[model samples]
Target: MFKFGNIYIIAAVAVIGGALFGFDISSMSAIISTQAYLCQFNQGGLDSDGKCVGPTPDVQGGVVAAMPGGSWLGALVSGFASDRFGRKTSIQIGAVIWVIGSVIVCASVNIPMLAVGRIINGFSVGICSAQVPVYITEIAPPTKRGRLVGFQQWAITWGILIMFFICYGCSYIDGTAAFRVPWGVQAVPAILLFCGLCVLPESPRWLAKKDRWEEAREVLALVHSHGNADSAWVRREMEEIREMVEFERQNADVTYFELFKPKMINRTMIGVFTQIWSQLTGMNVMMYYITYVFTMAGLASDDGTGVLLPSGIQFVINVVMTVPALLWMDRWGRRPTLLIGAFFMCLWLCVNAGLFATYGKPATGNHNAAVSMSITGAPAKAVIASTYLFVASFAPTWGPVSWAYPPELYPLRVRGKAVALATSSNWAFNFALAYFVPPAFANIQWRTYVIFAVFCAAMFIHVFFMFPETANKPLEEVEQIFDDTKPGAIKYIGTPAWKTRNTRAAVLKQERDQLASDEKIDAAAHKESVNA
Candidate 1:
């Protein structure tokens, strides 16, 4: 069978899993405001102004939240599936599951049925989100790992952009077809992902865990050395992997409980909180309900294009800004990227909140009361621009780093389980916010942005003091850094090496020189033996 050996090809195909997540996101976001969707699922139906009035916020929230609720469970189960079935097979399973879910969603006749279908789709997303990063991280060279794993986030944004446009185009169609067409179309990516997995190699680290040494070496060479199994880089990587795998095998009985133990708790906290913080950045509120946000900002109207076109611009900005992270994440490193991202997101959110609070007024009859307050004129434009700024900050920073950082934190023994746990934290928070935000908009009004701003501020502080820089370090070395560094309960106590590490160029040069010294030593020893 023809197998894909190019790391770029593997990343592109595997990140279709991430695209599936993106598809699900825009699948609803694009259509939620359309008349057909409002007519089909909303009980109160369209108001005098043709906006969805609905039977309370929970119904809409539940419909949107179902996928993430299912995703939370799917992420938990993914660890077992990836560990037992291999990373390639786990993603294939998710793809198959997504097709089934999309079909149910497309065929749904009512809200209950729609929710069930979305839940199923969420399950698939949960699995793919947890494992795609794991697979990519395992195959990528240390120097390029950030860029490759970053493809997952990039794929997600592309999925969002593509699906949003697809649904946006379909929104012009009459009746329920507006939603059904796009919902059904979501199955296409999953089908492509399932077929793509046929030619993709399993994670080499997974192969090593199964005691398939030769297969592991072949995969490593395929990815890193253009299929030269005997290449020095390949040999060095395989040896390191073998050592770690064997070391982990000694305690192979490790389970979820082990993640909570003193030795592992710090990493577990970092991984879990990283995911939670990403969701709390309030970006999802923008993605899931941008139309509602724009309505509140007084930029939207009955025609929907006012909201759709601007929201489309936001999605475009999200996709375009992410390219920088893929290019420079390894060089710029994780710590600074996160800190800067968080601070700016917080600033933008604050700006958005102040604009809304200062210039907004109570929403009047037939003018989308769900948004509660409306801001017009200059303040409203500032609100919209601040949202774009917030997304730009998130796209290159927390967006990719959250996914890339967690998988690098664990040892081979429990990597799958640990990553699953971290991703589950993401879904759990996602489910809550998806359900909570609509009602929050109606009740708390501008204060919603205030809450997200606070989350961004707290996360900035946390990253500054807690997150270790993992850029350019081998996965094995990342574990050692965590062990070697001490965590303190207060500020200015036990600052981490991430604050002091040399530049990426210096680090790579040091490793290359060490490898040369080792090779020369081995050559001299062999020559002495031959002479004797």
Candidate 2:
């Protein structure tokens, strides 16, 4: 078998797809404020400055959020590919799309054109968001699976951070053409990812389930030279995957309607609702508009930074937070982190928004600011600090753990479909938030916070009730729980929210496992030393 030591390098390579997702996500937010990006596309006619002139609130919202909206459509692509083509191929396809989309976006002439390009990029993001975890989970040694799969989230955050820096630097250029540089930089990574895919082995589990024994054997040999170690594991895994696929195939054709079937019904619910919760936690809303908040706070021009350094800092913070999944996720699992994260996110959101709400519209500028002139704080500082807290809350827990859970919980055959549904749901909700936020800010600016807080509270309750601890649990173990009709299956039905599997016992067990593993390694090293 391949040494466990090599898993990280494999994970880092596979998870570049996540980086593409993250890069596309925050990149467009930076471009929205640039006058050149918004130039001359008028619903009715152009204004004196050659910008579209109208009080088209909804239109502005759509334009502002098109990238996220597009992602929803793109996210569905993974389900189809993962189920049919395999996770690796789906990711490779996404890389191709990312490069094309980046070029189109960099060369865009108008807002609508830019939106088209963003939609393309969003498609790739949606696919990667679903595929990366599945790929990682399949390749990672089960002992470290949760943490390794978690690396995808960390990669995303890192991408966001890097893109933010690119955006921040490019924004200083003061023209639309200058903005192109940051957008263009994305192509480099996409191209590299595409090149990398040429040599990547398809997930052996995927190969085995497809009845491609030869391919699976070849792939396994590469991963592990110790006499077809991967092949042995694949045989065990394939039995289960084959059973699930046969069950799925015999039940009914794959349909949009099938997601609601009884066996899949619960998984579907978790996937979709959790995704909605992930977005509604108000993380994206903050990322989307915090720059405007900063400008209103007085960090940038009165016209607003559109996006700012404070926002960049948020990206950096998110990136930093995102990395922890690589180290802690295998230990902490999913539910506890999400529950705690939801509360913290909501708490900070309330605090930040409440502080801003205290200033009211006058200082922040209502659409009809002339009618209601109110004094507000130099929102820049408040905006910056609040967004940092918001993003920080996002990256480590809700952001990473959310994606982590679905892939781990679902069966190998169903994983892609499940993740696809969930990811698309996430993208859809993201679109809604992005599309709605500006107008909502225009309509009942402060009330939006109230809505988000409600969602956050709902998220906390939902996770505590429905979501269980997946930390250190094998994929088989998770499915076994779901498959079990025994008392342990019913055991947790009445269990108190906080007293679930992700307990101190679980945590201590994880620690002991780590220590024992280290001792084994040391012993192996000494034995090798003696042999040498």
Cα RMSD (Å) per model? 3.2, 5.3
The worst-scoring run of ten residues by lDDT in candidate 1 lies at 484-493
Top candidate on TM-score is: 1
lDDT of 1 by residue, 342-373 (tens): 99999999998898888999888753445688
Estimate TM-scores for all models: 0.94, 0.83
| Candidate 2 Cα outliers beyond 4 Å, as residue runs | 1-5, 35-57, 217-221, 224-256, 302-307, 363-383, 483-499, 503-532
In model 2, the Cα lDDT at residue 429 comes to: 88
Q: What is the lDDT of every predicted structure here? A: 0.87, 0.69
Candidate 2 per-residue lDDT, tens place, 1-532, comes to 3223256677777888888867766676665544444443434355443443332556656765777676788778787878688878888888899898889988877767777888888888888777888887776655577777777778777777788778777766765655788889998887877777666778877786677867766665566443343333444445555566566556544655666655556667776887889889877767655655655555554323544666776777787777776577666767778888988888877876776677655543223211122324565356457667777777888887777777776766567777788888888988888888777766676667778988898889888777766666656556655432443243234354355575445546765786576556657867888999
List the pairs of residues colliding in candidate 1.
Answer: none
Model 1 residue 428 CA deviation in Å: 0.2
